[model samples]
Target: MNQNETQWDKLLKIKTTGRDDSHSDQYRYPYEPTSYMVLERLANSGLIRKNNTLLDYGTGKGRVCFYLSYQTRCRAIGIEYDEAIYQKAIANKETAVAGNRSSFILCGAENYEVPVDVDRCYFFNPFSVEIFHTVLAKLYESYYEKPRELLLFFYYPSEDYISSLMTQEQLMFYDEIDTSDLFSGDDNRERIMIFKVI
Candidate 1:
C-alpha cells in the first residue's frame, strides 16, 4: 500500500488495501482493491448518482462500495465470494461513513442474482470470460424483467475480457473514463469502459 492509499483508508475509516491471490485460479481472479484515485475519478464522472444503486462484482473489502457511496451518496452493494474478504467488508461497513448506503453479499459473481434496482454495475477484471458471460446473462435477465436503464463499467479490463464484451450482442459501448494520465505508465488498460445493456 502507498501513502495515499493508506491516507484514503484512514479518511474513509476502512482498511481495504493489499493483494490476495490465495483463492485465485483459472476462473476467479485475486482480490485487489481499486485505487482511491481511480475511485475519485469515477465518482466525479457523473455516471453514478445519489439515487443509483451500484453493484460491484468482486468487491474486495468494499473499497469501491464505501468510497462511491460516500462520494456520490449512491446505494452500493458489494458482492464478494471470498468469506474472509467478505467478512472484512462487513466489518468495514460497520464503521464506514456511508455504511447506511452500502451492503455486501457473500456470493460468487456468477451466482449472484442481480436485483432490479441495481442499475449500475462495476467490474475490474475480477473473473474469467466464461464467468463474465454468465454474470452478463444474469444482468440481461434482470434488464428484461425490469426494463430499466443499466450501465456496466469495466476498469483495467484484460484483452480477453474486452474481446468478450465487444462480442456481446446486447451490450452497446457507452462511454470511457480515462485514467491513464493518473498513473505513471503508457498502459492502454488504464480506463473504465462503460457499456449499456439494451
Candidate 2:
C-alpha cells in the first residue's frame, strides 16, 4: 500500500481487500482490488467529468466508485453480484466521503439495468466474456434508447476481454494509460484501455 492509499483510507474510513477466488464461479470472478496507482491515473485522465455518471461493473467494496467520486466529483454506481461483497460495500458506503455521490447495487452486471444517463462504464477483469457481452448488450440497449455518448474504461484488461471488446461495433479505441512501471510484470500490457462508443 502507498501513502496515498493510507491517506485515502484514513480520510474516508474503508478497507478494500484483494483476490478471493474461493467464492468465484462461472458468472462471477474473483474480487481483486484495482491498483490504486492505476485508479489515480484514471481519475486524472480527463476521460470523465463531473457531468458524467460512471457505472462500475463488479465493483467490489466500491473502491473505484468512491475513488473517482472523490477525484472527479462525479456520480458513480458500483455493481457486485456476490452478496457478501455487496454487503461489505454497503458497509463502506456509510463512511465514504463520496457516499452521496456513490452507491452500490447488489446484482450481477449481466442482469443489472444500465442507467440511461450513464456516460462512462468501468471494468477490472470482473467476469467472463459471456457475462461481459451480456452487460454490453444492455448498454447497447440503453444507448439506442437514449443515444448519448458513452465510454468504457477497462483496467489491466485480460486477453479474453480485449478480444471481446475489440469486436464490438459500438465501441472504438479512445485512448490508453500505461501503468506497467508500477508493477514487476514482464508483459507491458499493464495499462488502462479506454473505449468510446462508435
Q: Estimate each model's TM-score.
A: 0.98, 0.94
lDDT of 1 by residue, 44-110 (tens): 9999999999999999899999999999999999998999989999999999888899999999989
lDDT of 2 by residue, 1-198 (tens): 567766776677777755667679876789988877888888888888899999999898888898898889899999998888888889989988878999998887889989899999999889999999999999999998899889998888989999998898899999999998878857667998999876
Off by over 4 Å in 2: 1-4
Clashes of each: 0, 0
Instruction: Pick out the ten consecutive residues of candidate 2 with the lowest summed lDDT.
Output: 13-22
Q: Estimate candidate 1's alpha-carbon lDDT, on a 0 to 1 scale.
A: 0.93
TM-score top scorer: 1
Off by over 4 Å in 1: none
